[model samples]
Structure formats: structure tokens, C-alpha cells
Target: MAGPSSFAARRKVKGVQLTIMVVGQSGTGRTTFVNTLCEQPLIQHQQPVAPEEAHLESGIRINPVQVELEEDGVRVSLTVVDTPGFGDQIDNEFTFNEIMGYLERQYDDILAEESRIKRNPRFRDNRVHALLYFITPTGHALRELDIELMRRLAPRVNVIPVIGKADSLTPSELHDFKRRVMEDIEYYSIPIYNFPYDAEEDDEDTIQENSELRALMPFAIVGSEEEVEVNGQPVRARRYPWGIVEVDNPQHSDFQRLRTALLQTHLHDVKEITHDFLYETFRSEKLSRSLVGDSMGAGYGAGQDASVNPEDLATQSVRIKEEQLKREEDKLRELELRTQRELAERRQELLAKEELLRSLEARLADAQHSNSSTPLPPSQPQSPIPQQGQPHPVLTPHGGAPTNGLQ
Candidate 1:
């Protein structure tokens, strides 16, 4: 967590801030996608945002970039939170703890500068609005680990699963990928899209200005066509070239839907969801502690002034003891079952090994017996069994010794 000075530093920035966190595995094109959101010349004017480029007080790596767009007549501030890639280095409990702790620290940071956050950010200021969860293009399904992580995340985060490297997929293949992911985790109901960023190229008067060079470009000024095999027939699916222009192009209906949902519905819902979870989790912990204290005092004689109070204390004690006994019994049963299962497995393994050993021993003994019993018929005579018209030894053209008749 950062010190008060760091909190003050963030508080100084005033605007309609909507934080959109982009997270994913390494090589999933997170940086490219964020650059797409910027919607400018990516490599030219846009500075590269490495994981460690922008540092915060917390150990977690994140780059904060701003995008200005107008929504409802007012300029909207889109704060893209580009997160570090997850892999062998930035993975496991330590990284996860750092991220969660960073999020926790935000609550304190916000409260300290509540007035500034409320006044400065035109959008709802206090919470994370949405999360863009980037995933490697797995044409199969959403993996179990991804779904589980989604489930455990502070439920308020509106997560949109994105398949990076969409250009590699045909239109039909992209649809299949979406379907498989949906089937795997129905709870990941949030929208999904392919990488929404790419280098924008113009195909205008430059063609007229340099006709010879324009001819050199492959498929220059041609309609987009996708090939697919349908019912044992090769088919070319065509779409207007101009239609595939914007990020999450109109040709990609799913991505368009995703963009709409993110900008409209999910963004608003996340704030309420996150706030509720925070309040409820804190409330539950407080309630549990209060109940435990009351139970302890009642059991001790702190609240035993009245004669009727003893019965109440006794009843409470009995209930607690019964619950504890039941838990112990369950634990004992589980332990016993586990031990029996292990013993049975071990016994089966031992029997298999014993059988294998016996078979090997039998084979070894038979081999030894065969070797001992066999003796070379001492010095077989060189003469062949006589047959009517056969020569005993046949000579070769360049022979030092005669060949056997059999040869």
C-alpha cells in the first residue's frame, strides 16, 4: 500500500475518470489492444507502455493512459489500466495478493479524497467501472483456471473476455471459439471480443498518386473474402471491404455488441456490485465478531444477574458443544475413509507387483533349465545325408572351401 503522500498525488488529478483494467496472459496482445483504444498511430505518436513503465507505490505493475471521447454531449475520460502480463514470474499467490491489496488500498485512497473524486471525475468516481480480461486465442473453450479466477474476483468487476489475435481466425472459426467459451463457463456471461486494435491504413488518393506502386500491394482495394469448408464444399464468404474498418469492426457483430455492452450497461452495474460486496463482506466480519463476543460473555457469568439467565447460557453452551462434536465426527469419518482408501490402493499395487515378480521368476527359471539341458551334439560329421542325384558338396566359382548341399 502507498503512503498518504501517494494517495494525495492521485487525488490531485481531477476528471470524469472511468478505470478500465486490461489483464491477460503474456503474448496475448494486451499492449496492442490498449493502443487500439487510443485510436492513433500506434508506433508513431503513441509511446510504448511496458509493464514496468509507470510505477505506483504498490509492487504491481500498471500503466495509466487517458483517452478522450464525447458521450452525451460531455467529454468522457477513459482511464486504461494496462496491467502486467501473468506468467512464471508475475504469477501465483504473491502476485495475486499484490493486486488485491492494491485494490484494497484504493478504497482508502478514495475516502481520503472523497470530495475531489466526486467533484473532479464526471463519471462515477469511486470504483473500478469495468475490466477487460484478455485471453489467448484458445479455439476450444474458456479454461477452468480462467473461470475460477473470474468467480473469485471482487464480484463487482464487470469482466469482458477478449480473444487476442483475432486476425488469425476466420469468421466462422471466431464464432466457434465464442460458442465453446460460453459453453465452458456460463457464469462468464460478460461480453467478449477479439483484439480491437490494429494499424490503420488508408486506401485513398494515394492510389491515384502512385498507380504503379498501388498495383504492387497484394489484394489492394479488393473486397474481403473468407474461405470455409461447408458440407464438403469450399465456399468464399465475402463482405464489403469498407465495413471492416473500425476497432471491433461492424463485420464482427459479437465485438460490436461487446463494445456497446461495456460502454453502456456493465460499466454502470459494476459500481453498485462492487460497493455492495465491500459493504457486505465488512458487515459480515463485524457481525461474526460481535456474536462470538456475546457468546463468550454469556458462557462466563457476565450476563447472569437474573435467575432465568442460567438456562439461556446453558442452552447456548449445549448448542455450541453439539456443533463442535458434529464437526469432530465429520473430520474423523473423513480421515478414516481416506486411510482405508490409501490402504486398499497400496494392497492392490502390491498384488500386481507380486504377480509380475512371479511371472518373471518363472520365465528366468525356464530359461536357465533350457540352457542347462541343451548340449551341442558333439562334433557333427561333415557328411550330408545321401540323396539319389545330389552332390555331397558343391564348389563355388571362387571357392577355397566347398559349400554344403543345403546352401
Candidate 2:
């Protein structure tokens, strides 16, 4: 038993999983950042397109790559999903739906699995825990595309906004850029993951840590696969004409802090939020829509068509749910009234039985009293005459008339 228990514990420890998706335009240094974060060439850089073929639209593609990593002595099965050719098209409106569809598809898989009578032994959960949206280093504010993508996707995933290639701007410019981006997000009411913590419910260290991380929203990122010798030690740094920028240095970039938070400090928190909140919310909306569709007959079944507007579907779903709830409440109230009526009828029957019992007892008491109060009659003498055509009366030896009957 001890051997098997220990083996199972080890197996569980070895299977810690985390999925992250990177989304941004092509030149935002997403590939470099991922490689730098993983300390390997996990993703191959795309080839440069020819000038003649540059006009072609490739659309959006979602590619998931899995790798094994060890962080803090725990084996992590990490899946990095890359969104290439996003926001690169002329319109880019359909790209949002593509990304959203992919995210919801994973949720749909889990929902289907949950509804199954028999569970699949080899089920794999590919739901993304965090999304790192790389912002191009513009030294200004968020673009319309950035705002739109984040705003649309924030409700479905944990969006951690980061500026790719932070070394392109001055320190002051980078600070102001971060401020403006956060302001735009606030103005738009985008629900990005902001390192949430509760002061009253959390410990002092947690509150402080989360507060600091929140202040550093839209982390500045610098990525390099090259290593350079600095101060008699080799470190990952990007060489430049004037000075070298170190990837791990706090003064240079927020890469190290972001890495630590993603892999070590808050990995479990990210996964928990994804499963407990985001996924559950989606699951509920989906099930509500399905239920509403089924209850409203074939018209709602046809409403599931993609040609129908999404806002209309949402409105119909809410209305149906409200009607269903109202019907259930009415049924419950009727049941309660019926139960009260039955209880009242039972009470009346019991009261009638009690009254009848009381009447019977009174009658019985009266009969007993009459019998006890009455006295016996005096003894009567029998005549010594016989009936006509009858035998004469016989006497006992003592000359007494027969006591059996009158003579």
C-alpha cells in the first residue's frame, strides 16, 4: 500500500499542467518573447514573405505547442498556443470570432464531457489559463485593434497585457505608454487580469505582493535568445551600439517578474480562475441558451443558425430563462396552497370525530346513572289456580308452590 500510494503521489506531482496563449501582431516580438521565456527555440520564426505575395491574406491560425518544463521542483506540462496572422488582414473583424470560437470550443469539449454518462479515460483539457497579449512598442497608447481584441477576449480568458520589445523606447516613454494603455483599458471597462487580492481576506504579504504586481500592469518586456558576458558572468542580453539590455534585470525589463509570476508564484491562481470562474461562466451561458432553445420549439432551434444576430440570441435566452423561472415559482405556490387545503380538511375531520366521541360518552354516563338510582320491585305471590285443559299444580314436599313459574 505504501509503495502504490507513493507512486500515485509522484505521478500526480509530475502532471501539473498550464496552458498559455500568445496573441499579437506579427512584428511584436511574440516569437522572441516566448523563446526567451522558455529559454529555448520552442517556436520557429516564420519565413519572410515575398513582396509579390504580400497582398495575399492568410487569415488567422491557432497552433498549440506543448512542452515539458520543471519549475520549483515540479514538472509542468505547458502548452503555448500561438495566434499567427491575427489583426494582419484588411478587416480583421472575423479574426475576433475565430479566436473566440477556439476558446469556447475548448469549453464546449469540457461541457460535453461533463454531460456524458461514461467518462473518457484519456480526456485532455486544453482550456487556456492565461493569455499574453503583446503590445507593439509605440511609446504612446493602445491602438484600436488592441482595445478591441482585449475587450472582446477578456471575458473569456485572463489577458495579461505586455509591451513587446520594451528596449525600443526610453524609460520615461515606456512608463507613460503603460499608463496610457491602462487608462484606455479602464475607460473601455476591459476586464483584464490585474493580479487581484483582498486586503481584509488576504495576508499582509499577499496584499502587498498583489498590489505591487497590479501597479506594474502592462509589463514591459524585452526578449533575446543571445547570451553575453557581463561582469565575468554570462547572461541573456541584447547587444546594442551604446549599452546592452539584460532580459532578467528589473531596470531593463519586467520579463523576469512576469516569468516568475506565470511559472512559480501565481500559476495555481491563474488555473483556478480559469476553471472556477471563466469556464463556469461560459458553461452556464451555453447551457442556458440550449435550454431556452429547446423549450421554445423549432423556431429557437433555427435561431441557433450563424446567420442570426448574437444580440438577438442573447435577449431571447434571457427572456426564456425568466419565463421558465416564473412558471416554476407559480407551480410551487399552487402546491403550497393545495397542501394547506388538505391540512385544513384533515383538521376538520379530526374535530368532527372528537365531537362524536364526546356525545357518546355523555349518553353512556346518563344510562349508568339511571340504572344505579332505580330500586327493585317487591315480591309477588302466585295463585294456586290452573288454566282450563291444563294439569293441576304440583306442590313440593314442604307444601310450597313451584318457584319455576306461576301456578
Top candidate when judged by lDDT against the true structure: 2
Task: State the local distance difference test value for candidate 1.
Answer: 0.53
Q: Give candidate 1's error at residue 195 in angstroms.
A: 21
What is the alpha-carbon lDDT for the whole of candidate 2? 0.90
Off by over 4 Å in 1: 1-15, 41-60, 88-91, 110-126, 154-156, 187-248, 253-255, 264-266, 276-407
What lDDT tens digits, residue by residue, belong to model 2 across residues 1-407?
Answer: 57986787667555588999999999999999999888899999989999999999999999999998888668888999999998899798999999999999999999899768578999999999999999989988889999999999999999999999899999999999999999999999999999999878999999988888988889999999999999999999999999999999998999999999999889999999999999978976776667566766657764565655677767766776688689779979999999999999999999999999999999999999999999999899987677787766567778986555454
lDDT by residue (241-307, candidate 1, tens digit) is 4433233444532343444444543444455555565533433333344445675675645243343
Give the 10-residue window scoring lowest on summed lDDT in candidate 2. 301-310
Q: What TM-scores do the predictions have?
A: 0.44, 0.72
Query: Global lDDT of each model?
Result: 0.53, 0.90
